[model samples]
Target: MFMTTDVTDLAAVRAEHVRHIATTLRDVRGPLIPILHAVQEDLGHVDQADVPVIADVLNLSVAEVHGVVTFYRDFRRAPGGRTTVRVCQAEACQAVGAEALGEHAKRRTGVGFGATTSDGAVTLDEVFCLGNCALGPAVQVGDRLHGRVTPARLDALLGEAR
Candidate 1:
């Protein structure tokens, strides 16, 4: 089961973000992208309410704003479920079987890439790199990164989070 936030309040967040984005547009060339990124960074995700605000502020069609939002994988328009589990899927990690480790991690957490558990205790994320190539097959729980995460090791990692 999934629980989403109230859309009405999200609209308010978007409205304010739009105003800020408009200011950025005047100051920057491709204001919409940066503004959206900033909003996501500050708010964790972009709110739907801001689409109209962005469109109006950037002099873009609402559809255009929506397009840019969806185009980038980094931009999230909703909140993360709860605990974030980032599995390194970069080449360095994969060289040491990170792909298989990621698959196991997802199954162990009961959530796929970009998904959260029913209890909202965990959200699984796929990341390309953690700059810990030496520690291939790395995973980051919250902000702590772990290396050489085998299936057995995953249980230990999950234990720390729980």
Candidate 2:
């Protein structure tokens, strides 16, 4: 059974919801990652409230489940903004002023990485790579990717997202 809780309701992660997710995927080999992904996909973030429920259902300790959640950058502990802006911070991107661009983004949006804007319009994230190494300073605005991005280009992207 899918969670009846609203998708945007991070705190609505009920034990039954986690139980359903865990039970459905339990038979799979090494099910932790997949289950976590499913939960995030469904709930926007892996609420800490659901960790113990998942652990109990999967017969694992809460620490194990929490460890996996914390270890992976893909899992968010809080609700993300309506839009996600990921800046490539890998060596290649950094070589081309990505660091400066990242700073500009944070300053412009008034939020650090892993934080959402005050208006809830955007979430700033740092990504190690976007595989567009040839075009350093790559960035992704929602589903679309751009390369060789400057601070101005990032501003346009954020504007569009807003």
Candidate 3:
């Protein structure tokens, strides 16, 4: 599900997002990382429909543009589901069994990074960090962050949302 969206032509929105991206990169020299972030934040996702527009706005080849978007872990070409569940996958979290946590989430949510539940109750993303390194295996559900997440702990955490 999208947030804070209003009626507006897709072309107009994409162009506006492009302008924002251009403006954001006006001071920076190379790389469109900043622009990409701005665009994603503004547009929710960089829909494939805007690829050409983004290329023109950033003066990048289509391949180059697509490559950058896909290469980065942060970019999303589609809107996130209702609940954005971000489980840390960084070294600190992984050291504390984040790998198992990820599997548990996949099995439980029936979706992985960039995926949403059928009813859109949740969206799961394997983020690299949540800045809670001391609380390894941390999982962020929407705005709330939790530490020491296990399958059972995650189950209880998710139950609260229902």
The models' CA-based lDDT, in order, is 0.80, 0.90, 0.80
Candidate achieving the largest lDDT:
2
Q: Is candidate 2 or candidate 3 better by lDDT?
A: 2
lDDT of 2 by residue, 111-144 (tens): 9998999898999999999999998899998778
Q: Estimate the TM-score for candidate 1.
A: 0.76
Query: How many Å off is the CA of 98 in candidate 2?
Result: 0.7
Error of 1 at 1 (Å): 34
Enumerate residue pairs that collide in model 1. 14-50
**Can you write out model 3's per-residue Cα lDDT over 103-151, one digit (the tens) per residue?**
8988887887768888767888888889999988999988899998878
Predicted candidate 1, C-alpha RMSD: 4.9
User: Can you tell me which runs of candidate 3 are displaced by over 4 Å?
Assistant: 1-8, 129-131, 142-144, 159-162
Taking all chains together, the TM-score of candidate 2 against the true structure is 0.86
Clashes of 1: 1
